[model samples]
Target: MSSTELPESVAAAVDPRVSPVRVAEGETLRSVVLPGLTLAVRSRSATAEGAPPALYVHGLGGSSQNWSALMPLLADRVDGEAVDLPGFGDSPPPDDGDYSVTGHARAVIRLLDAGGRGPVHLFGNSLGGSVATCVAAARPDLVRTLTLVSPALPEIRVQRTAWPTALMAVPGMTGLLGRLSRDWTAEQRTRGILALCYGDPSLVSEEELGHAVREMERRLQLPYFWDAMTRSTRGIVNAYTLGGQHGLWRRAERVLAPTLLVYGGRDQLVAYRMARKASAAFRDSRLLTLPDAGHVAMMEYPREVARACRELIDDYDRS
Candidate 1:
């Protein structure tokens, strides 16, 4: 909602704390501290020294690790970094306890401003998609191109499968669910998520599943995990109800960057029908519909997503 620029004093203050997290062979992880926020940034080694900078944002309950499969694929074209929002991944909760879409967008804006990496290719999935939309709209000068994968935008007729997630926004529902699932194992939780998120759960390798389970286990141990999930869920719900200038659709219409919209035919959360509306909202936009992929298209079909992203950048470059 405010300027994308971070104050000089805040930008200069860097917390030295770093948490140990899994990093792929060609990727590295680090911590970034600002005034009231700290973020875990996962970066891939760019194939060239002067490649354009890019930033990736993950969905609710996901970490920077969500982009692990896709970042390396774009290494040749962009110096990629994926951020773990407050209270997700290795990043701790924000001091203000604000998990609103605007809050997350501000965190991202601060990070980019502090790093002096404006006009970067911005990519987001699901809830992160909503954040990216807000960022691009509010600070068009900071975004070069925008890509959204199964963005959780407002829907007129919500899907039955997605209602449960949306319901978490209700007061006390998060604690109730937590108590109900107190006996559930991390593996069980991971499998349930995989089944819900992936169009074809069997496509996930055992190693990948193992990593997910471990991550789930670690998150379950965090004192603020469920709180972050509940508040962020509420944020999305609140964002959907907003109208006028603050509405996500209105913001999408204001985005100036070349946009790429990816929707999964089998997505149980975001409806496939919204793709056309999204394409129409962003003036300069293209759509990619993947019939077999689900919510996390980047993770499920990285190569195809990467190729589409390349086309977006290439087309933007030519024009």
Candidate 2:
């Protein structure tokens, strides 16, 4: 769809494809074809001057717009582009229907190679964080530094009270969710989701959340929405449980990039206690605890997140 034709929510989340950030004006929107679908690409001119660029990936059921507000601010400090992971945002689903972490990482690698950015500053959250860790570990050459916000690593054991992930894991739960709320409408689904992700449940305004709710309604109409979500959940559970070399923690240990791990002291999804183990996983990593933030801290406390992101960059650039 044309930029103007896109929904107001989507529009608010990302600049028009023509709006360049860290790249030259001549740069334009491009698509990189992976097995099942294509990734919609956009770039901004190097507003950071000569600084290295960051590559951002959003969590499950999220899109590139998740980074819209933070990008312009960070662009001056570091070049960056955010991506919509397959089946979530604008990106398409995987060929194997494999929503596994490795599957997502492979797609990311393809996007990086196709988009022509090298050794990027990597960032991710939740499912995307797990995928990002896999990418950095599998191909360290492509990542210069790493920043993960509430990344879903392999739990030492399941963190208690993470109801969302727990619900996802319950057999037949999605179908049950779909059946119980099938007639409830997409707007309701979207609002319900936002409430689950945010501890305070007010980070998303009724107006703003209404837009997201509409977006969800439109997307669910697509054939793959439910399947993609189910597969993506399966992928996360599978990748999250991997042992030895294939696990998220093992990959984190292999990541040579200086890493910054951000966790909300109140985050319900990834759990705060797991943050300590995550910090220890990366040899060159340090932890930044957000005492009052929830799962999506960047969205809830944009200013603090921006400051933390800057400090991480400073340390990376200095060392």
How many pairs of residues collide in each model?
1, 9
Q: Return the TM-score for candidate 1, rounded to 2 decimals.
A: 0.94
Q: In model 1, what are the clashing residue pairs, if there are any?
A: 119-142
- Residue 131 CA displacement from its true place in model 1, Å: 0.3
Candidate 1 lDDT over 33-110, as tens digits, reads 798888878888689888899999999999999999999999999999999998898788999999999999999999
163, model 2: CA deviation in Å?
4.0
lDDT of 2 by residue, 145-164 (tens): 88898898877556666655
Estimated TM-score for each candidate: 0.94, 0.86
Candidate 2 RMSD computed on C-alpha atoms after optimal superposition onto the true structure: 5.3
Whole-model lDDT values for every prediction:
0.90, 0.73
